[model samples]
Target: MAAPPCDSSAHRAFDFWLGEWNVHTPDGKLAGTNRIVSEYNGCVLHERYDTGRGYSGESLNTYDAGRKVWHQTWVDTTGTLLLLEGGLRNGSMVLEGQTTGADAKLTRHRITWTPNSDGSVRQLWESSEGNGPWSVAFDGRYSRK
Candidate 1:
């Protein structure tokens, strides 16, 4: 029998991030906890993150066969919605998008998730304003819980 549609290696590119994790800042402060699970016959990855201080977010990630890219839709408690798309690059998943702030300023958001040799994952979020220099918004490391 043939393998399932979602069993392709492309669909499994994000498998390294599948698991419960303890997220910490570079300084070793506990930033939050996250849980990522594969679902929909491995066609989708669902992630839930909580800061344990009333801040939480969830995202659904999938690989678009037609677009040949990975997509992510994230929604947070603050009513922020982010739609990002990209694919594997340089051994990491890099996704980027643009959003307009309440002040009507255009902001570019880019996030990269890289798996480390120590079995940990590093996530870095950067933002730039209207072609300005990129600034780090968040940098966290994920270790299996």
Candidate 2:
């Protein structure tokens, strides 16, 4: 059977991130590489991340029709799993969630993806504990491969 059409704007919100990319840190150091592919008639985005140091992970991203939001589940070889949920806002995809840190404190995590005019993408990850200010956890730029 043919797959259902995913032509809605919501489903295509993340299309700008679809491609093979080399990720770099803010200092210009190589961070990793990623390959993002659209699957299931564009209903799903599959991501493969390799840190080039034997560390790798995969994430499945999708738009939940019922919830009207985008969701992502990432699992890595290091046994780290992260689940984020959100949708596009002001041309950027912002996903927010809560996770427990090593100190057993709950941290609010927010990740934002912005597409640049040059076709590169910027990803910023921040975390905050309680009512504390958010601190940058990761900031990376993705250039097309």
Clashes of each: 0, 0
Q: Report the C-alpha lDDT of model 1 over 1-145, residue by residue, as the tens digit.
A: 9999888888999999999999999999999999999999999999999999999999999999887899999999999999999989999999999999899999999999999999999999999999999999999999999
User: What's the C-alpha lDDT at position 119 in model 2?
Assistant: 100
Candidate 1: misplaced stretches above 4 Å? none
Query: Model 1, residue 45: displacement in angstroms?
Result: 0.5
lDDT tens readout by residue for model 2, 1-145:
7546677888899999999999999999999999999998789999999999999999999999788999999889988778999999899999988877678888888999999999999999999997699999989999998
Off by over 4 Å in 2: 1-3
The per-prediction CA RMSD against the true structure, in angstroms, equals 0.8, 2.0
The local lDDT score (0 to 100) that residue 128 gets in candidate 2 is 91
Q: After superposition, how far is residue 60 of candidate 1 from its true place, in Å?
A: 0.1
Most lDDT-accurate candidate:
1
Residue pair clashes in candidate 2: none
* Cα-based lDDT for every prediction: 0.96, 0.92
C-alpha-based local distance difference test score of model 2: 0.92
